[model samples]
Target: MKFFTAVAFLTASVSAFTTMTPNKVASSNAMAFSQFSQQSALMAAKQVPHGGVLVNQMTDDKDAAIAKATVEIQASERQLCDVELIMNGGFSPLTGFMDEAAYNSVVENMALEDGTIFGLPVVYDTDDESLQPGTTILLKQGDLPIATVELTDKYVPNKVLECKQCYGTSELEHPGTLMVATERGKYYMGGKVTGLNTPVRDFPCKTPAEVREELPDDKDVVAFQCRNPVHRAHYELFTRALDDPLIGEGGIVLVHPTCGPTQADDIPGTTRYKTYEVLKEETANPRVVWEYLPYSMHMAGPREAIQHMIIRKNFGCTHFIIGRDMAGSKSSITGEDYYGAYDAQDIAKANAEKLGVTPVPSLNLVFTEEEGYTTADEAKEKGLSIQKLSGTKFRKMLRGGEDIPEWFAFKSVVKVLRENI
Candidate 1:
């Protein structure tokens, strides 16, 4: 019998896998997919991880053995995020949680053993020190059995090193740093996972395989990553990205939002999902696609930007939008930004060649009094009148029942925010 991994199905058109040699890392010039009008393109169509999409299917014979497992461990919310992405092929080429070696490699360098540019380390960390190496742990979320893992390696990690490498600082105020510094479990477990079923969620969560089917294979797809509600400027930025001359005609946008736990102050995932749903119906644009990811926001700035690119590649996106301070988070105590405004753009641009997904710098669109919406540069050059409303001001309007200008946001989106208030 022949076994086929999920990546095999995703990259069916290509027979040979392309590895990224150090020399392949070229200048960060992301071309619009349409510009590659040739008999063959440089990058492969589908981007899979180092080993391929790691899928662990349950064997018929092993079901009985799993049922008889002695130890049952409840999975934390973070671990469930890993389980959903791993099982759904979103985290392609990762079979399960990272082993100690893999974790250490990712911490020291953002690459796996074979030099795969993986951004973050995904591990099953728990404070349960008693879960021995030989134990068969049944991981469950809210009383629902999701996966079974045989603990092969259980060890403590250097938390300081992990945070410093991934987040660039170990400050307690920074959310990403805080997570690694304080929230994660002490002991990390590493092993293969036998997925039984995906945990149920209230919001719409689709796997990469499902999204690929919805996207047209021959057309250009640009992915927009967002955690906040889509304001008019944001909508303009991504939609206009497709209109760039370099981008061939008939390009569509994927409005992929991270509907998972983020900063403590950001809008709730459930609330954000409603806004996207309303906006999708209100705008009624066939060019824009909607999907939600269960990825927990690490706010690792540049590194996280690369992580988004890799995941979107597996989702069948040819291009990804890298905006100012993408995936940026702040320090709660000091109220300071963790990364520079353009750091993510620079990093993603540098790795665009190796990542396969072209990086489209997000347009800085602003509303003009006389000319609808235009890029900031265009507005300045043409001396057009521009209007602005800070997020704090918008929230005040929403709360005070003030009129939100049609130029700033969709009425439908406003309705969702107003209802929440």
Candidate 2:
């Protein structure tokens, strides 16, 4: 019986597999897939964006496990059908089928039957999503993503969803327009904008404008802007927003987390999304909607903070949950680094009218022992169980394999992170 296994193997190799001279082309010039996988791994590492040339150059023989297997060439959509392909030559028990260094390098250029996408062998500066015919066009420049699309853009600038209940002129909000350090010619909103969410089962999925239009219109929606991993504070903020006495209704809370290539220690997009899924399932938060943000991190905490707010508006959200250092929380505040903890809220507080969505500043929430966001700040100070959690700090814990406190993070969110960390 013939079986089909779609392992990430190489298509060809250079001059190392053949007993015949390096340049000599013999009858069995091609070796087995295993041979190519092992040898090709070596050649792949030397080059920056590993490619087939490194594999083919391994030896004169082509020895993939299966000969003439179907392969999807990286960068371009040159698909080969019915050919044997070799796996990455190296493997490890701890990791799995391939060497982390070589496997990672090669996978970026190759995709298996599964939908795992990797970066390409381009020069460092030219790195981007694997460009293919069906690739999602989430980004066109530096770091902006399609997730910035507005839930309500008709009245705001370039917004797709109009505020049906908005009291003032239904303003069209700008889609994905964040005021990042503007020094005149350095950068400016080109009037072009993109959204941050789309339907997909995996990371790096392509954004379809047609598919986006198909999202069921939510007369009532709750937008969740996730720049960092999900923590107790995030939960506290959103639950409060959804349960707002004035704003609470039948709104759907969108589980929108940015999925673009974020820094290490920061939760991987897939892990974060899965955590959100578990949270969604555990809670009967009927109004919650879930989708990964397709944009990459700019590390511009404050400015990107405003951008997140504006994007939520395009998504048809009437309110957004703002976290500390929303955009640039990686570095320190005074060292020309992370956005100030309150910058995101500050920006939102100043621009709610100009941008249009109701921003939830952390200050408004009065954390208490009994309830998370209580309006008790006016009466008396209360001790909160949940210690303020930080994404940067969370990542350190993730990398360290330390347990995140249930108080800082929901018990469920912590469980998911522990498994994936």
Candidate 3:
């Protein structure tokens, strides 16, 4: 049978096999239908959001929400990112900023009040202690109103406790801990949000529903989360993830990069987005789908992996690729890594089954003179000559106008970075 015809046959036979008794259906056809049914059920399970419901807080009447606002507050870049995700169902199971109960629960147990796993608390922070509950506030980007919140509760957050619990450390050296301690406001506000407009951004972030619509219903969708420009190794890693046994055949990888506020020193979102656009045009891979996510990075390592998985699950991804030291950061003073290399992979793997999303550990790939982009084990066994380039060296090369090896980075991506940086 032709490939398309075989698919049609399996789909058509599934229903018939379900209704037929034992020995009534042909054994070979029955086996094919059984496999097809399992795949269908798996895909169906992935479609369900983390909390079994996808939350949509976007308001149809923007004028009404604007008029109801008694106070206006300019949102920070991070807050804007959070608002976009919350409004678009990227932060499903979350209708708005977390209340005190929810915040405390997530900080203490990494879960919501209802025992639903939530990696971190999403709360609105402000220094204005005079703001009271039952008041309406409009959150804006500059003069443009983006979302409105009906304040239900306001409380001082335990910054140290939150940093320790969510990020595994309360040290000022840790970026996430530092952010919570110095950057966040004194008061944490909670309310249901009504989105008025999405912030103006260089890259348009698609809603979870929109992304889900583009994904294949019968094939597994593997999510690759990144905050930087895609390099050649990064390309090989995600593309190879499609061939993983967990993904099986006909699976596709979603190159979903966060085009929102990341580390202060990282590439600008606009520049990074441009690099992706150029690389996508250059490669034109059919098995890959590129999309942008408006999420602010926390550098919380293991905990952040859970957060990414939940968000991708809402976007209809069945699996997530967990790389070494995923979302990890370093100490500004000692320059020591905050989390272990395998910490994220371990935590993500531990929670994968419960989240309904499988965690695919990224291969430790290395570049060799004899064979390009082979697993570290294979290179070591063959005693191949390995090529290595550090990030510090790469940046220097970009500054010096040195030609970068195509094995280390893509030519198109290098061109964009060189021009932008």
Best prediction by lDDT: 3
In the range 1-421, model 3's lDDT, one tens digit per residue, is 1343223322221111021111111012222122112233334534567766665677788998899999999999999999888887788777678777778788898887667788988888887867887789999999899999887777766776787789998787887877776677766777777888989998988888777777878788899999999999999999999889999689999999998877778999999999999999999999999999999999999999999999999899989999999999999899999999999999988887778889999999999999999999999999999999999999999999999999999999999998999
The TM-scores of all predictions, comma-separated, are 0.86, 0.46, 0.89
Better of 1 and 2 by TM-score: 1
Candidate number with the higher lDDT (2 or 3)? 3
Please write out the lDDT profile of model 2 over residues 85-105, one tens digit for every residue: 111110110011121222223
- Sort order, TM-score high to low: 3, 1, 2
Per-residue C-alpha lDDT of model 1 across residues 204-249, encoded as one tens digit per residue: 7876766776777667888999999998888989889998764667
Please tell me which predicted candidate would have the highest TM-score against the true structure: 3
lDDT of each: 0.73, 0.37, 0.81
Which should have the higher lDDT, number 1 or number 2? Answer: 1
Instruction: Show model 2 residue runs off by greater than 4 Å.
Output: 1-220, 245-248, 330-337, 363-405
Q: How high is the lDDT of residue 120 in model 2? A: 15
lDDT of 1 at 339: 94
Q: Model 3 TM-score?
A: 0.89
State how far residue 235 of model 1 sits from its true place (Å): 1.0
